[model samples]
Target: MATLQQTEHNKTVDAKNFSRRAALGGLLFPAVGLFLGGCTRGLTTAAAPKVAIPEGRGAFALRADGTRAFRNHELVDQNGVKVRFQDDLVEGKVFGATFQYAKCEGICSDMTQQMKKSYQLMKPIMGKPVNFYMFSLAGDSPAEMKAFMQAHGIDNLPSWRFFTGSSEAIADIRWAFGFGDPNEETDKNLAGHTGMVRFCNHKLDKWAACPAQGSPESTARLVVRLFPSNERPQLAGIASKIATPSYPMKNWSPAKPLTANLASQL
Candidate 1:
């Protein structure tokens, strides 16, 4: 019943209202989408956790001077060179020692593998004349030690040396180095031996110990700690490049404390 002009005016009003509603709907939908997107993004970020930095054991500190003279025991190295403790092994240089036997099926392999990794980490500073010595606990022959070193890819490494001596000398060295009682019967089928790696800075008369059974990176850190501060930075940088292994807490106890003198430090 409305006139043509009035009808036109109503249509125009309805169209304006519809246009406003459509525009509002468009704005509302985008706002809701943006809100949802923000929430989703926040959730995703929260769910992807960052790797936590391991708790450091404080600054590198040396414990009490617990060094004992390496007795005048005769030993033959993997290279068939006869080495004496004073003239070859410690002679006012930084050195590290770990126990191994060729006949063991147990942790000897793991220890050697870790040592190889440690060597790789320390390779940059090998020129500093840092040395590593592996003492045979089972009195392995030089040929046997050479085979072990070759099998572990460390035979050709100039910085690492393998040594073996008579059973009596080996026992005396083991006792002096605090590698636990040498008389304990070990399972030949198991990797049964002291899994410790001991290192010393003869110039500083500082020494420390770490489990060789640990990750190569951790073992490398311990070895680097024995180096003088000037030589440590490079080795530490190399160690950082290696990934740390993540494993559940081990139920087993170490055969001996890493350092023979940790108690004295305390």
Candidate 2:
């Protein structure tokens, strides 16, 4: 009976010890959690030191160039060469840009054909550097873009390039160039895409666009006029031969002057 009583007493003491340890552990965990929480809060609230990204290499490099609003997203060409959008492509060159997808069944082909025709027209009369960029909206791989170029029967030219990149990058370029529709839903629907060709002379700070579905001749003229007067004297002489309509033509709106500042409104 004495031994039995001693064992019971020991069991009670052990139970009390276990309860105390568990309670202490519970309190200790909260204290540790609070310390970690404080440390995390301090780290998050601290200002990150600025690091200089050489030649605009980082994620936020696009915002560094103040002259233009477009991001300098990375893009790969049909030939598998990587280039920066605003820096390598559009810096001082007069370039025309179009958005497309490799498998698009709609007006994408027509748009490309129009650009081809315009290139033929402008190449012979141009004395300045010019380029044409066909940016893919579907974010295809470089090989896929090359295959798409081949399937279209379009030969890659030194001055003309086809590009595919991340969808986010492409979206930034697309909306930046004013290719999206005013209606949000329509803009999201790739089928209802706005088939417009955007032209920019980064040096002159001039930008313009003409309907790709419209006459290629007009598109050619619109692009040629973007060049300086001395460089495109041939085009300058014939500038009076045609003009944008005083009123809206076809299903499109009339021509309006565009400036770099208007990118914010897009």
Candidate 3:
């Protein structure tokens, strides 16, 4: 009887010990796995460093709504002064840009004339100073750009400036301004260059474009809207009082969506 009781007691002790160990292991194993997994994740994170800005594309320091990038290439102004394109002319400024050569007798002339009218309309109501830039697609010298401006009767406009650079640089700049055709062959045709006017409020990163061939009033309205509401009271009030004119739709077509690359850049 004593042997039997002792054996039974030993079996109970053994069962209790095994149960305790099993319960302890069940609680500890999950915690150990979680700790090990966390260590592995930390090591992986430490191995691959994060980059703040993308490589080779930080020239613009773009924001979520940033329209596009610009080159800081050296450019010559109409006054024969060398200036950095973004730093000297565009940074923290509200401006309009047009592209043309010194010798174009077609749409370039019309575009310049339209821009002159637009500026005149924008001047009276603008509370703050704004600028206009004309980049030469033909890489015209400062003197040539001055001559072109003089012939257009816009050389005396204080807020306007003309710029020129090497042909290669100008080519790159044009695309930066979102003024290129996807079709390489079409883009190479200089005579068929874009007639759109690019508008930017660099400080706000707001960008817009309008057809240079459009009515001066239309273009002026669009550009004026880029200015701060407080700075455009006169123009904004005038616009509010005027009614939108009706246009004939005989030849009108619905606007198509921009190409993917162009859309992404802008």
Candidate 4:
């Protein structure tokens, strides 16, 4: 019975982790299962409003420089402003983007912690015009969001905006940021899927997916250091991984060559 209980406990923990992962990609595939395209969420950035960051989980990265994904889409920031590539989304400053919700307890929370560390590292590099936008999967009210932000001591960061929108709107917008797939449906809400951050020049038409955590400046410096590195290794080292075949993404193919080396990274 004790052994059975231990096994049960392990199963519970595993289930929770799986739920969190599914939540990260909840918008992608709203079905129950571990395999198939059951990734964190097979985010697709189509015609949606560009999933709001502070709460909604979805795409934030721009596609290849010349990619069409870079040309379309718009996002609303904390100041109640609608922003996009061709718009006043901050022209010269480095910007950061992430996804979270007002009441996340698991991976979303962990992502925020990592995000904060990354933002702090990039703080000096950002200020006026240099901004950070975190979209909410919840589309929480501004009043509630502001209060919570202030409580967390995040109010002083004038340039950082926590954004959210109608749940349905965000579900559609997630496609633009590639953070979640909005096509599927289930009893579970959008809160489950978490997404990656993207650092953009704001002036360029391109978007690059960011690392899970670490300062953006640090990440930037690392990228520069790795400039000569083949794009393959750079992507391999930076992009977060999910068990493939089960995961969803258009740009990266599972680094089948990863083997034991990839396992260590995980």
Better of 2 and 3 by TM-score: 3
Determine the backbone clash count of candidate 1. 4
- The alpha-carbon RMSD values of the candidates against the true structure, listed in the order shown, are 35.2, 24.7, 28.8, 17.7
Which lDDT tens digits does candidate 1 get at residues 91-205? 3567678878887787888888877877787776553556778888676788999999898888888778788887656654553454432122331212456788876665555
Which one wins on lDDT? 3
Error of 2 at 118 (Å): 1.0
Worst 10 residues of 2 by lDDT: 32-41
Model 2 root-mean-square deviation: 24.7
Cα lDDT listed for each candidate: 0.57, 0.59, 0.62, 0.45
User: Candidate 3: which pairs clash?
Assistant: none
What is the overall TM-score of model 1 with all chains considered together?
A: 0.59
lDDT of 3 by residue, 1-266 (tens): 00113343343234333342342222121110000000010012122121233222112334334333355667887878777665566545677788888988779989899788887777754325467888888778889999999999988877687888876567656655656443445656777888988776665565678888788888887876665665543554226566889988898898987999889998
The segments of candidate 1 whose C-alpha lies over 4 angstroms from its true place after superposition are 1-68, 182-191, 236-266
Q: Rank by lDDT, descending? A: 3, 2, 1, 4
**TM per model?**
0.59, 0.61, 0.64, 0.48
Candidate 2 TM-score versus the reference = 0.61
> Which numbered prediction scores highest in TM-score against the true structure?
3
